[model samples]
Target: MSSKVIHAIYTDDDLLMQAVKQTREANYHIEEVYTPFPVHGLDKAMGLAPTRLAITSFLYGLVGLSVAISMMNFIMIQDWPQDIGGKPSFSFLENLPAFVPIMFELTVFFAAHLMVITFYMRSKLWPFKQAENPDVRTTDDHFLMEVSVGKHNVKDMSKFLSDTGALEVNLINK
Candidate 1:
């Protein structure tokens, strides 16, 4: 069966939370939620899982730091040792402080790049994907709740939404 989406627009946070509670009470499955800005406790209210991006970013940053250290150590010590002002250059232990800048830069660089890419991929926000929003107002000043429903329950869901203070509601067929 094809999935049909019902989009509910809300202007009031309390009303929106109530609607979400009611939807859960009715056993409706929420597809996604959109808000112009973050709402406190919204994720828990929607029963969404905590994101794992932070851990992934940390791991990637560690890998980048290790690579930077090894590369810098090998190049500056073993491959080509350059003496400036009669300073000794050997392994990383000899000049550990000198590599701090490169290590920090690489760590931040990898964390930022990999975290962003991971978030984009996890959210399925690749290029050329058409906007899933049914209403443009939701992107600016409104909160949107997308729910998948059966054809038979469309009217009932719409009525519930209207009763629960939805500013607007639309049904999209997949």
Candidate 2:
């Protein structure tokens, strides 16, 4: 059986938000929403779970810190044992202050770069990836809301979207 979906387009973000709320209230299953830019509170409005990127970033930072510490201990205290500014060359504890800047920079670098990579991977965004958006206008100024039509009437769904301030509504068979 072919799947049917309704695409509701809105010109303004506010209208899109209201339409989403109205659609949910009317018991329509919203498949997705596409916007030109990030919309504040859109996830909450859509009842999506909070992201865990911050926790992953912290873990990446910890890994970076551990690598920095191990690398510094091996290079400075164990392998080469450089004597700079009359500081102790054989003890990592005594020379930790000198490694603080490197540790901090590496931690920040890992957190930032790894977080970006994780986001890209999680979002399925990669070089030369084809766009999945159904409407190209959604990448510009339009906001598109997709509603799944399992057993709902198509005309009723279109009217509901129009009533909720949709600029245009189209039905698609997928």
Task: Report, for every candidate in turn, its global Cα lDDT versus the true structure.
Answer: 0.86, 0.92
Give TM-scores for every candidate, taking all chains together and pairing residue i with residue i: 0.88, 0.95
Candidate 2 on 21-98: residue-level lDDT in tens? 888888999999999999998898887889999999999999999989999999998889876888768888878788
What are the clashing pairs of model 1? none
Q: Number of clashing residue pairs in every model?
A: 0, 0
Model 1, 1-174: lDDT tens per residue?
567889899997778888888887888888888887788888888888998888999999998899898889789998998885787786568788888999999999989998999999998999999987767887788989998886447889899888878998898877
Candidate 2 clashes between residue pairs 3 or more apart in a chain or in different chains: none
- After superposition, the stretches of candidate 1 with alpha carbons farther than 4 Å from their true spots are none
- Quote the lDDT for 160 in model 2: 90
